[model samples]
Target: MVSFGMKDLLTLPITIVTGVYTALKFIYHCFLRPLQSGNSQKTRLDQASLFYEGQAGIYDATRGGLLRGRHTMLALSASHLRILRETAANKRLVWVDIGGGTGHNIEFMDDHFPVSSFDAIYIVDICEPLLQVARDRIAKRGWKNVTVLCQDATVFWLPEWLDGIDPRGSVSFVTMSYSITMIPRFHAVLDRVEHVLAHETGLFGVADFYTAEKQESLIDRSIGGLDKGCGWFRRWFWRIFFEFDHIFLGSARRSYLEHRFGTIKSLNGRNHFLVPYLVQIPYYIWLGRSRFRDNYPLDRSLELEYVSQESPGIPVEDVPLTPFHYSITKHWRVPYFLEPTHEKFHSFTRVFTPEDSMELIRHLEVSRDDSVLFVTSAGDSALHLAINSRPKQIHCVDPNPIQGHLLELKLAAIQSLEYEDFFALFGEGKHPTFRSLLDSRIAPYLSAAAYQFWKRDKNNFSSSFYLDGSAGQALAFMRSIFGVAGLSKDVIAFCNSDTLVEQQPIWQRKIRPVMCPTIAFLLRFGWRVFGIPPNQWKMLLKDGDVSAYVRDTLDPLISKYLLKTESHFFHLALTGHYTPQCCPEYLTRAGFERLRTNKGEATDAIRLHTKSMLSALRSLPASSLTHIVLMDHFDSSETRGS
Candidate 1:
């Protein structure tokens, strides 16, 4: 029987067909569509391995939300077992928060659940910078039970870390708080947790935006928001500009990275080799989220939209002014600021105080053509720019609404709540505080977390202390909060980020000793440069030993705060226009302003004109107006953060 053998199966016709299909596909990809894929680059199967190493740098700054809430979640989930100092013995509770950046959760646990006894905390993450920060933070806290490591939850699971340095069956609770979503293949992490969990009795929780396809489409659409109205020119320019990141992380060191850290596990949706990473840019952009544009406008707009829709009884026009409207949670993060900044160059030398704003505004005058934007000008800084503009179309955006609203309320309560009233509101100290009025005023609006942290002491220090969470500046608040219980500034500073500890929370400790030098160097450099004055190096990692990698990454602050504008980037963030893409002040550079008549896309409008020489000259028009302030379209798009 002449059976079709291997050679016979390779018929000329079949071979030709295969060749034609392959050739056509190649042609289409090469000629028809644009292809900037990095398919040739090494595939990343063990993503955590690469990412865990990078955490030492990205920690704290990039981690979504502060580490405050995560601890509460863990403590709440604790199975009635006393953590750390249990009343009964042998009922040891364990926790593993995968992808937990910086191990702040551990301190949270240590702070609140001190009554209970814990065996260990396993913090897992893929970025070394973050892990290092986590380690440094744990060390400062003086936590003894916590442990951290930097291994991919997929492909390789460290049994010793999971079980114990002494015993193997001492596991308890496992959590994933917004960390797993950043991972490509989080299943491995989940599976390892399941496998090592203290059986079915072990507690498992995930405080993540667990979107099941429906949420995915919502996420995708939200991400695609960056594409809408981006215009071809801006889109193309950004596509290339963002690609530099791909070259640095993937293209340049593809092989060496793979050999050194194994490989990233999840490369899903990789339409382009660089697509996986590049896609974030468009998503970032389209959400109308510019680092320059404060998110209050978009966030508040959406919330208002939801409120307006859900409560048909309410009119859209009434939403802004209606007392009932503010009572509702609708429109949480709207574009409250008129214009914002979006320059990568701005983050370094950001406008820090109200004085900075005035410095820049001195050179100009505002007229009909000029739409002036104040980074934040309703309260303290507002006092600076208020006189500058005649009609006053100033807009305000701050993150801590409790704090901001308190400021707004202060005026209404002015004479009614005078002198000591101000101190009583925020003046718990032996001396009078500048924020005395606000402290008394914002008492009702404290967040559950803020309240929880503040509850330990009955001497309510006032709103200014709790309002210390100035965007990119949290040290003051930490100091204030710590001071309430008699913690000294030096001890607080040391405890805030002591890098001397040997072990870390599960979120940090990614290094294997070999990477220590590089880690220390970078830490030192980042603390010295990017760490800023108020934030201090210790705030990031509490480390005395700085690494070379961290040191080299430090760059000078690029954004300048004008003493003239009565607006500063810090104030803008306080007002709520904080994002990485742009700063509100950047729009001022383009000659735009904030006025009652002013509406929509300040930075973008100016950017379009700036691209053209004659048009930009025509747009501003030789002092047709007196002063020009720049702040528009700086905040980037935010994913549907459900």
Candidate 2:
């Protein structure tokens, strides 16, 4: 009615556009623009607080899967604490969870570590909104032990934060969960943590995003696995991607931490953002003690008892006491067990053998009456022979005392536990209550050295204890390699394949390409951690192409034996454990009974020696041995011993 002109209609369209733009601007100002406004001029704490102001409500929901390794880090820390708590009577546990937004990590960790067990839990963060969320979560649980403080992590004084509960710099555990990447002064924060934990036997743990520089030296790169750093592309792409949201993914954060502490354990894992276009993010969880020897010092007396044998001068108890008992006894004056020492013989750290026991048995053609003297790589081959072939007597010996301990545990488990429990302990490769089981049942049958070794490593059972030794590490490395090549599914399928025919196609199609020259180079270098000594590697490459040797050696093992479901070694490598139907012969019920009881229904056939094979053999009478499975003994030997 006012005007019937084209100009008026065009003006209406302009007005509509103006209204939409205003609405969008208002929304951005209210929510998103503030997140991007915290510039370099502002204090880091203020910036963090401003960023998290509106985020705390949705923090847990947003970060549930984006943040990884919370459970694993907590579990490892708690296991470490279990050992400390048992030793310390008067010491009260103190925990300081840095940047514990919304109290989600603590709540998640509650399964592994009881929140109330700590005398105090100080949730420290600069954001009051986040702290309030933590405060509310703690309050709802009616937990009196937890206290939330909105303080700068870089300079927060522990004594003041604790309200004078304890003097300054006294805390047992200081953990940073997914917060180190957000700190502007992370180096200063780490310095503060190192200071706060100065007085106590503390563990400083952190899980955060990081990018590691690529190595120019292939040799160095090969040895530097996930525990060290990432590749060139991952380091660059992730650094830029995370830096956009005010998060830093520099290598300095992790390098500085390692320089400040004695590394106990560190693991790198990838967390996928689950969004369309976002790539997988690499994060690492590290646990360490202070650089000083105050925390968990190497107990000289305990080491002596575990590594030493009963010599003539030392008063040997009729039944060897646990290492804990020896620690309390303080027998520093006891003479160290005398064994002729050689560097080459003592270099191996693996308590278990990587060789396939079934293959060894098949190739050796061992008889029922064979008297076997094996090098005792884990004593698994000996046990297999004993159970399958019913060997007359088996002598398992090693220079490293730890290997003897593993054999002793296996024997004790066979003797005391049911088939199911034994399978769980050794076959499935883990048993949560291994310590309790060892104390109540297995320890009585073990020697002083063997008892102490297993006692020290009792916590290994908390996870896959089978994965603790070098053989496990090799399998783990293989699994990691497969995962990188996106062949994990193919590996699972191959491992689960019932017949050779079923697995051949899968291997050729999906797995063969992963064995490229690059993988071969990396694996050859990584063999060091997998228990292949430098000299042994040289011996393997003496006559043939290294890549061909590796491929020929592994192809049949993986495709034929593993796919046929006859090789538990590869099965365990592919999957963390073995099914009852697919485990080792010694792990089966019939095999367990046969080993536990001989044709005469007795259980004293297997023997373990903690001394060198030469010492053990010299002590035995001549013409006493039949089958000697040296496990490449001459390959590593410098000279013949009497």
Candidate 3:
């Protein structure tokens, strides 16, 4: 129907043109479009709900090799299963592998603990092909206890989700090893977990793609894998695909837990580090200047217009505790290096406590009590302890007014509202009274940091980050607590692993073989010795070298005093471990005073409080304090002394 000359040949038929364009478009999309694999996960990648459904063929053909330490993950999870089920005095538990195909995870655990009698095992996943792979892999070894489910993990109310499972502690421990990175909006999944997990009793075993920091460290390791034809494209492709997961997506775990649970046990369970990208470090920021003329601008989330609504019109109410979904690998890498505080960790005896208040009120001690001032170096708890004790005058000063406000509000919710009701709004069980109390007297002087953490992202399902702006101080404090997990133990471990995200590269390739095996062995042995899970081991060790870099690098004074028991950091507000938020702050002397530092202000007079150290009682004033509670827990006398 179409004979063409040279000119006519240039002009193709509409059908032919359309077909060629369609084919090229497909090829481009498959290779380049982020929807195929992009850094910005929040954006819709394609018209289809299944993000990578069509690309499944290529994904399988070149899905990156088993992630580094995948074997260890299998081994660690299996070991845990063995210790739990087979071992006689263990905490009987159930295993739930979310996104677990047929049984790569459960199979190993089952093989090891075969006679152990598992309570139950649930393998949940979405893709049928993976499920098929899981099924085929699992069939190699039979597991009567395992049950596979091909279903959407986001479905909160799947009757079969945990129907067949039960545990000794009445828990179904869920593990998401390297799978959560695939989830785009993982918050809903978290909400489901919170609702499903039995209250006060359940271990959530989580591991995922490494953080941005780890990934950066691994780029070189990957290079070794690459230059040697070790599959660079696979590593780089998946690594790039996970860029958002390492930073933005994973960041939600911190915010989610704080918003839902109040305290951060682990942003992926390793208690040592504080994630920075989300932590608000002093990095180069690239944000556009706001175009709005008004001081307060509204956010556009599903619609064209919506105000912060923290506005007066709505009559502000506290948000109820809503469980968020953000599962992190137990491996943490934030606050750099952190240690759990030693004994008496949570035992900071507030001068305002009921028992202590009476002591101040008694006898000749009250003779000059006319100027009885209450200074809190504590967080929100100060108000309750102060008001309940009927302090003659309470001058609660906090460098961060937000903490003061929270304390104040906590005091109010305690006074006017109910704690349970307050908990509903904030999801935290501690004193709900702090919010209303803050609304009244304390709201005026909210700290700059607190305002940003609490109010800036109101609709966001996350925790407030007081550690970002004050990270330098927080880092200084963290090193003081957790004794660098015996890093020699860590480094030796690094040398033994098969595939670690190596940091340095040798100039000579011949030198490579020696380094690889040495590093691999070090890694393997470290986990074996320390009794740390593979997930946790990765969190602490960087480039297979776990020597506490951040902690050891602190100013010499901080490094020495904080770790050694001689320091007063022991009797402070550490959540059972050393953390960034626990350290003392020079910024909020008033707030720190109210929370009441272990010793009074670093005033010139009390500077001699230290018994052994050269440093004097530094930071505040003795005049700032009106009373002190002396508990004789020290060595010399029966009671403990500071």
Candidate 4:
């Protein structure tokens, strides 16, 4: 047994008292303290200085849990700077951090980007205490290139401007982390920001508290149709709660920011670390470029010529540009169709292709010079073509915008994810940290509409990305039927079989008798779940009855190919997931490695078009495409006279 002495008996009580005192001190400084008790006429600077005078020592320690998305904002800004620097390598890069408290963002940014790479950096703030702490940090870190300016953001200027050097349109980057809400004249500061940023290459990044409602009509077309709305209760509650601290959480700030800049990427997240209550606070991170039309660096004349399909002598100012022409991603996806109201297919129709991709590859004989056009059904065939042929370009056309979104998600996953994460997301059909990965890794490459769609439906991966869509529902129903009939073991065994001699008996003895009748019944009554329309069903009926059709389809597939090693389509049907040896080529290690090489040049070769196949074909130049794979679309078109 352990013995306790007088010193040990007193230690627990002393430590408990010290802990309680610290907790109360933190709570009092953060929440209970008043800014100005009796003077209501104090200026913004006076109020800010008095409020932060006592809390400056503990600000970093106490606010680390409350301030979320700061590092993410810094990371995104660093990425944009790297890309922008490549274009303007000869120019000097300048950065400005507005309302930079204690130089935390600049210090943290060194982890993502070298602070010495910039020619100059400025930290503008109004509070003296915070500026003193920032000066101390700069001295300790020995950042000779950094300067702290104890001035208001709206009237701040660089040292070169004082020497008559005219520093306007010279800054390369500007950032505000949780500081926009504290400024009384945010519009003036934003105007100042726009004036100082470089003409075409400047980048603006901001992360702050916000509240908004879901209003589709208010979405800005130039921002790629991004909607970051919260619930009604959250909108009202956070707005009222933040008023006590003189921090505004209304939507006006975001709206003004969007109006001032052309958005590149925007993400919304919740900070759930408020101790004692654990209430979620909403925050957002936004990145953008200059909004002036004249500042756009892309070739407007060439874009107009391409859109008109004429000679390259058209005057850009004479033609009115559509929203699609101003795409920041420079991809072919149309934003108007990506809206939820215009969606024809809310859920995916096919999880995997029924046509043999290897057979199609052999017959098409694709080459490096060939450009193939095909329907984007779950993106499996396109991946196969990209890996095998290494084509110059592949145009993926689909009427439903969700199908294009699905393909975009897969491409982004291929470009960013490691092989294990890629296998877990696609092969096993589920992942635990999909939302985190989606925000951090996969978001930079996707369009705003695609990012928003996945952000809203990220829970699909939490259960099973392959078990939530319409086709997956059908598979789920079939799985339930197999479970009821005690055929689950045989289904597993059929997928695990080594040879045709072993697979045929299990199929004939256990699965075939139950599967054929069910498929026949579903074909007659409920075939839409299988993505077969009335016209396609009529085309199928022209050959034979439903029972004979089902028998013919299953017998030929099972007789010709082994289920375990040869056919991944049927294996997925019997079992809801795929194994390493029996899966799509893109999901295999060798295929993934091939696509991952050369910084994802193969994935970049594919362009997505969200429109009808006819419209997509009409837009392309004649004789430009070498191969066109219609799959079963020809049958549907002939039946409908399209």
Candidate 5:
């Protein structure tokens, strides 16, 4: 019901004209622009200049949403550089940004690491227009350490090298943000990168659009963890879509980069910022170091010295090198074959160790010189060893891959989580923000398998991580039995008892008579839930009746130690969770602080192996272990034969 006047009619026409003009301008400058063809044999630089001449001014505004992972790439590089700076405090730190258009990446880096901290910063690109914009940015920021270079990335050199002095192995960091795919002859550029990067401390970071095949080689899968393959449609669609702008998204670029460097961390993601977030573009961020530097030969005398310190009688030279000895991160975990038919163990078998860890620590007297290896059952023993004794090294071996995943989650929680969050996760077995913490903070330190496992099963923490495993199910069964028999109050009272004297009366009057009989009968059918095989059950039967064995074990633990403050094993069994006063040592505030201090020195010393104990021992260097806590596994004849 509205009528337009002459001014309103004119305003509508003007607005329409402005919208059309802006759209045409953006399309012409970004997509429809013609290349400068003065000569048929134009160099790569000439083409790059022509492409950016009209788009440089509007580049940042137009492409801001399209270019993803720029910030993540820079932040990851900064983290590695900060770590490297600790070791090379006396040396000058340099950074080179290849194809760094308009100095946007350098400016964004200020949010993560200050730009002035670098001794020198260079922005190398083939486009003069972009370099000019970068120069303006540097001047506006008043940064004397920054430089804008209009040169090809392959032939670029530091200013010091121009004086006829070779500056090989001097640069500390090199980054390529969304530029590797645009470069012609990227192999030569990658080769030149190795020549200029420091042999030992250099780090290379890159993020760009890529297309991978549906299947990759075994070697690629092993070396490049989490670098997954793309679907056929996506791989084909993005490659053809980007080729119109002369940007190549082939898989060869990423493969060659991995071949040239040892991968420290690699992540695959999708860019979903285009076309109202419906179109997804595949991309990757890679952090790497020199492969040659990582695989350098070990000193024979030092190797023998380390081995003989732990085990004096074995010869070092006789132990051949295994694949476990050579890893990019120097961790003991290696790629192993996963059986297709095997059903994975998705929960903890033992909620707590049957063999007392405190008693083991007291008797074994684990010292700084000792290197201990033990089963990673529920990760209690290894964590106990790591906290109670700061041993030189601790190896956690388990054939069940999910068990290894659980241990990794525990270690990562110790490293990245605070005391309160740690308590909520392991003590109460429920955390609300576990998914967010796992994605942002914990993903970087975990392996691909571990990360994927936790990502899928993160909801386990939403209810109760302890209540989802087989051991948890068994505990639930026991609690249900207590509820039906109206003995839950007595059990709670027994766990709350301050001294053994208070516990003995409660156990003798109400708990033992009911629990002992029920346990003896349930032990036969429920042994598998507790991870007890038939052979182990048979061995238990050889000594005495199940009722007597149950009575003997429970009576001593209850009669000797205070249940509320002294014993976490029976406490967790009685209740579904542990109290702050009665829990594993690693769950204590002092223990968590000790493990979290000094960049997690205690947790860092532990290595996880997803293999049999015998296989792990065979792969280890001769005499590298000082103590071996086989636990009750040696009680099984099958294990003893192995």
Candidate 6:
């Protein structure tokens, strides 16, 4: 203070400026720079440590703003832990938190589930600085149970690190809180976690960012719609954007977890009000239990055998978790497809028999004693078999309740309505008095559920009921295209052509040229509208080219069966009506007599089912049916892997 030179006086201002500049740079890199993209100068682990080391003092404060769903995840974890604790009160409860940086997630959960709930809490991280910060936070909280250890989460099970904990899957709960995406070998880490988790008591909780690719099937799309996925473009954009920060947002992480465990609670949420790029960061919170359970045994052979013997006649509610039930419920809380609002939208209004029922009967050597399992789609093929082959029993099955309802309605109509009314409704594809008939004649024979379903949609019968359901959409689309291309007249001419030879030429020359290319394009890009899911479309083209499959295979087949024969199906496609000479067996005079005269026998012989084909088969005693008709069940291109 007493002695000052000219150089000393100059250094004071420079020192102050330098300190302020360094502070500004530190703040920018810790906060603002993370939000922006940049090339990484170090390894991923080193880079993560560097960012955390610099921001550790402000980590908890800064994270609360940008990171979302922490509270929700903690609540979910606490709920699961509470459930597990009831059963394992006497056992030593160990919770392992992999990559638990700063001990924040654990400390936050303490208020919810009490730190004393667990016998031991292992907070594992590779970064010593982050672990040091976690130790300080835990120490301040005075949680004697929590132990902070600096170790690689992916390889923490080394002999030196296993301090007397049971080696054979003794961990009760494991959590990875927004940390997996940063680890380079995350799969390896997950694999290790799965092994360490208690076989019967383990619960895993995770909350992290993820991006889902576009689903290729209608079922998949419906699922995605329920899941709240940001559409394909946004998902891809976010995935790439987050990858720059060594934060992976791929589907693999979530899918792997799902494969390893049974989901208990899962939710996908987006946080807004941040900057534009960070606004829609997709984070998911998931709670899952290990697939292994003490209450239920893994072996399903006994259950399968039981179902194989006694499923057919058992009440649907009484049937246990068969393969079919598992398929229907695995992805959704409820059967969304079977809900009344969605049911009618996807129903098949008219029967379009692509395969010749008479030919199938001949090939299979139809006999009076044979029992048949028929797929109930518009009830055309089953009715054909009933009339022509007259098999002893026909088990009509369809997973779609709407399709079964349609078949039931047809059966009720056959039992009650006279020949002319049946012909007008089905053969001609129109019935102005359908609602009157349904209430007066058809409703009496229908099941209570079916009756209710029809009563709600009685308006559908007033107009062209044949053109209302999803099956008619393809025909409607075709008609629109024909109108656009000026081929309506040509289509009529082809349908009107008398001889089989003349019909093929008319189809080849006029119809094929116009419709084939358009159909191919639609099949490739817009098959979903036609009720052809991507998986089903892939199955269609599994053997060869789509266009060639249509041209060489489908065209010839159609020419032989539909164009040449009295195939009312093609007539409906062309004119939306069926003539007397070209109609299903149910519309024929002799067939109608058999159904009308013997209503009880007809009803008894044809057992209509509104459940999955496999499930229906399982319900019935094994060897109950001599013949099985899968129909278009195998149309899906995507298999189990897809």
Clashing pairs counted in every model:
156, 0, 91, 0, 0, 6
Model 4 steric clash pairs: none
Which of the two candidates, 2 or 6, achieves a greater TM-score against the reference? Answer: 2
Candidate 4 structure quality by residue, lDDT tens digits, 417-499: 89999999888888898876776667656766676678766476786667667778777888888999999998988888888
User: What TM-score does structure 3 among the candidates reach?
Assistant: 0.31
Q: Against the true structure, candidate 5 has what lDDT?
A: 0.76
Q: Write the per-residue lDDT of candidate 6 for residues 534-619, one digit (tens) a residue.
A: 65677687878878866885576556664423666667767776777776667787878876674436545677666656667777
Give candidate 6 regions above 4 Å deviation.
1-346, 349-351, 533-536, 554-565, 635-642
Candidate 1 deviant stretches above 4 angstroms: 1-58, 61-72, 79-91, 155-170, 213-642
User: Candidate 1, residues 122-200: lDDT per residue as tens digits?
Assistant: 7765555667778888788777767677666554344555554433334566666655444445545545554565532
Among these predictions, the greatest lDDT belongs to 4
Candidate 5 deviation (Cα RMSD): 8.2
Give the TM-score of each candidate.
Answer: 0.27, 0.51, 0.31, 0.80, 0.72, 0.45
Each prediction's Cα lDDT score?
Answer: 0.36, 0.65, 0.34, 0.78, 0.76, 0.66
What does each candidate score in C-alpha RMSD? 26.3, 15.2, 24.0, 5.8, 8.2, 20.0
* Cand. 3 Cα-lDDT: 0.34
| Residue-wise C-alpha lDDT for candidate 2, range 362-459, written one tens digit per residue | 88877767677888776778777876676677777777655655666777677667888888887777788777666445543443334444654436
TM-score of predicted model 4? Answer: 0.80
Q: Arrange candidates by lDDT, highest first: which order? A: 4, 5, 6, 2, 1, 3
Q: Where's the lowest-lDDT run of ten residues in candidate 3?
A: 329-338
TM-score-superior candidate, 3 or 6: 6
What RMSD value applies to candidate 2? 15.2
Best by TM-score: 4
- Candidate 5 residue 522 Cα shift, in angstroms, is 10
